[model samples]
Target: MAEFRCRACGQEGTWVYDPERYTCPACGSIDVHFVVFRHELPDDDPAAKRMDELATEEANKRPKKESED
Candidate 1:
């Protein structure tokens, strides 16, 4: 239920969703809105590719941990 997009920073991902006020976790902007959730899309779907790219970028922004376990 957290499929959202940030209009402030263009950050899109499940983890970027803020439940408190639907603000952007990345940019702390309330200019975020929920988009249609896609369970599956074709390999050539541009939306899917964009989502994947954003997810990867968000993942890279996190601090790396040597070991979590």
Candidate 2:
């Protein structure tokens, strides 16, 4: 079991899937990334969900890039 998030919509979900072929559950987009949680707990564990939220917060806080000439 593994958790995944959609890059396009920030949608989070879980699936027992191949990383190469996984798609976002919310929008059916292939633009997604894995979110590692715990090895002992299932993908839907509350802790995992919380961790995903924190990760998203951190990403949102990152500085934006300047435009190149």
Measured by TM-score, the strongest candidate is 1
Once fitted onto the true fold, the runs of candidate 1 whose alpha carbons sit more than 4 angstroms away are 1-34, 67-69
In candidate 1, what are the lDDT values of residues 17-40, reduced to their tens digit? 222455776787989877634444
Question: What C-alpha lDDT do the candidate models reach, one value each?
Answer: 0.68, 0.71
Question: Each model's TM-score?
Answer: 0.40, 0.38
Q: Which stretches of candidate 2 lie over 4 Å from their true place?
A: 18-20, 35-69
Local distance difference test, candidate 2? 0.71
lDDT of 1 at 32: 83
Q: What's the count of clashing pairs in each model shown?
A: 0, 0
Q: Name the lDDT value of residue 54 in candidate 2.
A: 87
Instruction: For residues 1-69, write the lDDT of model 2, one tens digit per residue.
Output: 778889989988777655345578678788988764356455676765777788789989987778756
